[model samples]
Target: MAGRFTGKRALVTGGGRGIGRAIVERLAAEDAAVVVADVDLAHARSAAEALRDKGFTVEARTLDVGDPASFASFDERLDVLVANAGIQTFAPASELTVADWDRVLDVNARGTLLTLQLAARCLREGGAAVTVASIQALLPNALSANYAASKAAVLSLTKSFAAELAPRGIRVNAVAPGRIDTALSDFGSEQVGRITGQDAAEALQRRLSTNPLGRIGRPDEVAAAVAFLASDDASYITGECVNVCGGDVMA
Candidate 1:
């Protein structure tokens, strides 16, 4: 289990916090030299410094996944890529503006495309890519039209990339997370408050009741799945999305 990625180089977008940070830590734990790429340089630096303190080979960089210029400067060769940078906005369909829709798609869908394209250029043969999608992609939720649509597009891209990259000895996969207790999930509580007229805590409680596990998932849980897909252990898997949704998405 240790040193599964000894001497490997990995890049994780949005690695400053939450699920992305968790993925970075997991990869570093396995001995990969990890790049904590995020839009916020400070967060990325903080995460990298903390990991470095723990004796992990980690670095930080500012990367805007939606911008080609940012990706162009990413010159380091890579063995693993985790396309985890994304944003979520919640609003009723009628209340959603064009800007809201565009922003969500730009970051979640277009960003995934750009990240995968860069990985194609940098990843060595037999490398792997894992995308962070959402359970909402498969099980749509109220007031999350834009977020859900963008994630669904990511799922599609995962399959497409997997097929095209197979010839290059690269494997592409996705992890669809359930309700995870992160800042992103905290936003869900606000969304629930807006829709149901309840406080944030109550909204979260009501939401948690719907899951079969009767609780939200952890960021590290999703990271574990991504690490597996990125490792040689999942060599036979590609063009598939593994659900980490606590039985919320059975399909």
Candidate 2:
């Protein structure tokens, strides 16, 4: 059987843990040679080792998404790109320090641009790219202004790249995930609890209920969507942001 990505090569940022790791695993299982990039080189190597032990072709490398130099280095050995590296802090806009806001924007938005630029330079004419955004792109909250702004920029960036790369036969798209079980979300939920004095689980449950599906989504669910976007299955798709938000965003 010819796997969907049998001959593809993929570069996934933040591939050491959480949703990013799942995306890397899913792509490798579909027969793509994966490059797992993370800020934590140890975790990146461990994840790559685990995949390789399973007989997958994978390599680990250091990637600081907020740094363009990192992308320049990694682009030397890649094709497709998945910009899944991100961070968040919970606070009202008034309380969001300049440093925190800068960190989020630099990683989520600027980092995305750096990755896309590398993909445009390195990927073959028909190659694909996927940016991992968030439902926060559409559904803004008072506690996550910086995160939401960055995600909204991600969606815009995806469209801009799609337009710019369409002429070159390279496709660009994004997956906007809702609340999935991830360590990053766990940290954000804790911050939310501290700010609101509400139980983290209760806050999460209430948020999950807002989804028409009435539950939190899984990392694998988001990974599946990313795999599809990065595969030939979505060859004709570009300038689009797919919402895997469990019907939370109808548009």
Candidate 3:
């Protein structure tokens, strides 16, 4: 567990599972004392327990990313922050509801805004921040209108934070994952099946086929990228995004 982050402290929103959990594991493995912050306190505690058993420095905390007040209670100085909490829904544009749009934007956009803003304040000099975006933000896809818009907003906000924090020596970047293997992928299968009138397996096949690698990406793969961007290895990087979609952006 001795790595670049041996003495660093990190916070990861939605760190209880999926890509967020992967990021937390990666940081902790690199010796960062990580706070697993999730709306589900149980999940957070579970993640912390697993990592703690492995002798990594980890802690559990409850954080509702959609609530601005949630960030206020977090006053710990940090070296890294991964704003990875988000939700997704699938519906045809014509069928998309206002409530759905608001919920999506509120969590994916406003939540990110608050989380990263806190990071900009809490991160020490030379600290780094990473945001979890989606390939849908850059690609024109069906059944994800609200998700795409919210992630696109994340892209813009990332740049804004990067610019504003540069003078203070803090870096801000984003990762846009495509067809990652996570709980969210199950939702993809169901939604794609509904849209294409295909069986679950067939829909999943189509989704995989969209990647030039002809497979789904892994959470650890995205976590590796985040680790790099949030370390001194990428000290010159900021306001940038690395796509972890197995070349799905090309497909």
Candidate 4:
């Protein structure tokens, strides 16, 4: 059977690892030519090469999601754009340095905007964009205030873009994931442990227990959601944040 994304061209940011990598792989599996764009050039190239070795059409590029110039330099027409690049910081709102907050916002919120803007400029009519938000955007976590705030902004941005882009036959959506076990989460846990004197495992356990699924989500699971949103199967879906959070939150 032909996959939903067959014949498409997808650009995925942060494609070096975790959910981003999973999305890149899935898109290729569905027969879409993919660009694995990431800040880690080595990881990006390795991912692209591995997919190529597996007979999937894929390429790799270096992109700093926070930098507009980095994104613009690619200048390739795309059918789908997945703004999955992001970072996290752990500290009480009062304890976090301004630099830490800025870093998170730059990578998460600003990066998302740049991805959407660039995609709008280069994608053909009927193209789609997917922004990766987080469950923390809806469920408050004091230690992750910066991350949560940025993700909240992503949801709003998705809606805003959808309203403006709908006239052009473009759809914009977002995915808000819960406790997914990825390198980003691992790094987040480590920072949490250092800041709160708790073991990383303990912190993760506490966080994961909040999910109704009783287990953290996998990157592939989140990728499936993103792919769905980017496909014609979701043609009518726009300006929505599909929560892949294992029922951790509802509204």
Which candidate has the highest TM-score of all?
A: 1
Task: lDDT winner between 2 and 3, please give it.
Answer: 3
User: Candidate 3 lDDT, tens digit per residue, 70-90?
Assistant: 878899899999999999988
> What tens-digit string does per-residue lDDT give for candidate 4 at 28-129?
989999999999999999999999999999999999999878865877788999999998888898787899999999999999898888878977799999
TM-score of 2: 0.96
> Which stretches of model 4 miss by more than 4 angstroms?
none
List residue ranges in candidate 1 displaced over 4 A. none
Per-candidate TM equals 0.97, 0.96, 0.97, 0.96
Q: What does the lDDT read for residue 180 in candidate 4?
A: 88
lDDT of all the models against the reference? 0.93, 0.89, 0.92, 0.90
Model 3 Cα displacement at 27 (Å)?
A: 0.5
lDDT measured at residue 44 in model 2 versus the true structure, 0 to 100:
96
Indicate the worst ten consecutive residues by lDDT in candidate 3. Answer: 202-211
Highest-scoring model, lDDT: 1
The order of the candidates by TM-score, greatest first, is 1, 3, 2, 4
lDDT of 2 by residue, 1-251 (tens): 23988878999999999999999999999999999999999989999999999999999999998997776565464557898999888898788899999999999999999988888888888889999998898876799899999999999999999999999899999999988888888898899999989999999989887779998788999999999898878888998988987898878
